[model samples]
Target: MNRAFHRILIANRGEIAVRLIRAARELGLETIAVHADVDRAALHVLEADRAVSIGPAPAAESYLSIPAVLEAARASGAEAIHPGYGFLSENADFAQGVIDAGLVWIGPPPEAMRLLGDKLGAKALATKLGIPTVPGDDSERDRVDRSAEPKDQEKADAALIRKAKGVGFPLLLKAVAGGGGKGMRRVDRESELPEAIRSARREGHAAFGDSRLLVERFVSPAHHVEIQLFADAHGHVVHLGERECSIQRRHQKIVEESPSPTIDPAVREMMADAAVTLARAAGYRSAGTCEFLLDEQGRFYFLEVNTRLQVEHPVTEMVTGMDLARMQMVEATGKDLSRGQSVVEWRGHAIECRLYAEDPERGFLPSSGPVLMFKAPEGPGVRVDSGIMAGWHVGIHYDPILAKIIVHDHTRERAVARMQRALAETVVLGLTTNLGFLQVVVRHPEFVAGRTPIDFLDRHLRDWKAHESPPGAEVLALAAMAEWERLGMIGSGSGPSVVANGGSGADGDGSSPWRQLGPFRLGERRR
Candidate 1:
């Protein structure tokens, strides 16, 4: 039986949507992209077979609106909805809404998502399955649940404080329904616990619509590793491999690579088994990632499960040679795993660097503006997945990620070098970007040796900045020169092509054939 749909609606924006479009087209399926007003000219919208305007620029009025996305899918006659990564990708209610609308949800079952989406519920399941989880106060888990009460709130606060003290100082207050570091806070002392909890809860509610939080012992100098899992309704599950996402800033990963340089084969197998066990226990289907915090002592604990395609899925695909997005489409339509775990193999090392519209010099604040020039790196062992182009406006209403550059090679060393070379070749002018900072990180000594932990950036490159100066006179002059040559200003002759001053080539009578009535000029004056 063919377990594939004829058309799928990508219910997200940016590069991930572009990724899904290409994959769906390769599988002979029509792709539909839903975008906000600001994304009307986005590359993903242009690439898709069909596009629908969802709502305004703000995500709340657009991408995160379930009704709007469903309406777009209906209008496009899409048979399935693939929530590419962020927005409502891991949203259980959104999954249910899609299913209720009689459209296939191209992700894990809604119930599975609901179960594992709650940090406490997932931790309980992991404990039941004998998977090691971060030690914390599980006894008062129910009492600290999200609820409304001034009197009850005071009691809950005291209980939370007790739990935090027990968990020890330097703990993380993590939102139960959060990912991408949205609702997370790090408290280094007991005095900061109350404020941290209040802020984390507020952000969690605003970001995820769920304010429930959990306190866990912060594992410093730990490696952030996660195993990619694929399961189908036919009771088959397999682990592709693991990605080391330790290079991060503000709890968000900026660089990720496959075949962690830190973990040995023994620990790898153990973690893989643990991931599969948790997946099966939760009745997981479709693509999911089991995250784990690996301590310096080689001990690992279950962190959380991301119930959608990861942002770094390219690294896994590069090394394993698997089309995870296509596999997701097929599985959502009710299919079994293509192969067993025994057949799944990994060949080489792959690294992915996320390029964002931000100024690394100014505290990594998001930058938004028109992309005056755009060029992607091209070569063997290099891939660029982007959703922007020259003249496109990058809006501040969404994730700052502009593109992802992935490189693969026979070894990690070669892969890092390839990425460095690729970054140098790439260009995105007219806006501030973290391109230079990424190049520095990949070439740094600790990164080259794969000695990265969660605090790699903070510990090593706290003052990281672009070595090259911002675009200025030289850059504008070069741009002008390129434009002039393109406009036939230069030729084989030693003299100018048409006129002495490289002007509009006025005739002897000063009647220039190329002169326009307006004041607009075409070429630069000859030096």
Candidate 2:
């Protein structure tokens, strides 16, 4: 006779926050949003029934602060707190804090988060369940039982070095605490182990403040595929489907599509089995994503388990027609998941392209500023989940993600066509985004043919340079020089330049003269 939750507090911001709000609203539940000072006018803050200020713009001051989030939940009179995707979403301590505060935590159990949050621990547990994890010489333990001390993050340097000797050289050093490619290092030789270890510890210290790292063999040419699953307190669990997230940068996904084009039905069943087995072994509940590395031979290796809603959950939602957030809320309320997952069955194919505020021409540098013009494509099968508005200012402190453009269709081919059309119609005026590059990728022969490897972007790039400077600075510089010569801005002896036709306007204020996109005043069109 218990309901999971009636009112949920969204303990994060940006697109994911807004995403949870919509999903929860559709289920007829109220939502509360907590924000930092910078996001006072954020879309999520404005959309929620109620809002609370957590802290300043920095994540440490707001989103990641356990007390701040819990306090916001209490003040807003929320019955549960939903940690959407990032920030404190996967923090076991934060989850514990919420439960300790006498509120439901709308995610997998904290025990599950802690156990699988560590790559080494998850791999060991997967192996115990006969689930295939990437092969590594855990020479330290002949059979790595989850009970065995993870040489991946040993208590002593000498022990780690000794274990490394058995695992062989060129092993990966990754943080046992967090994901998103932070605190990771590759040591090719014995001489490199010390530096690699030190480097990893330093990074781990900075990112998670827990310098512990896990050592594993690195795998390449592996496609990243993850299966999203839902579990309720009664122990019923089901897989929504698989997502192809191989297109990435710095180990973070940029594009994700459900019903991976590369996976066969048999392969999907196998992967889903492995994922569910691992989750069941760990007593996992609520929404979570189990990542796998599908090698060239179509063999899958357990990668990690994300213990919260994913940024790409909507892709699954699009295909399955399931409200993942609502499912999570229901599970937290103690409902049988079989009922919910049964009600909403997965259908068609869905693709999601993350529209980041970055430039592809200039090594994908983070682009920021106010969005003078923002238009999301609409149609029968297309959807846009975004946090930015026409007048919203993009800041430098947070992630550069502007929006997520998704397309759903009965077939992958049709979804691709719809997605391509959606991309063409989408526009932003203030800063350079991945708009141009995404169009190119969607049309690229390798992508169109669906023959890309895991390192597709690495091979795609010609010059390997950092993207900290202004986006497309090099391209803009060259174009400006050409304009200077043609318009006679430099001297009379010049050719026709871009500036010749019109003068340049400031881009940060959303008044750029170089761009041609304007607002969509015509009522609205479905993408």
Task: Give all TM-scores, in the order shown.
Answer: 0.90, 0.82
Model 1, 197-306: lDDT tens digits are 77887888778887677889999889999999999998999999999999987789999999999998899999999999999999999899999999989999999999
Model 1: lDDT of residue 419:
92
Return model 2's CA RMSD, one decimal: 9.1
Off by over 4 Å in 2: 1-4, 137-171, 186-196, 339-345, 462-527
- The lDDT of model 1 is 0.84
The residue pairs in collision within model 1 are: none
User: Judged by lDDT against the true structure, how good is candidate 2?
Assistant: 0.76
Measured by lDDT, the strongest candidate is: 1
Off by over 4 Å in 1: 1-4, 138-152, 471-527
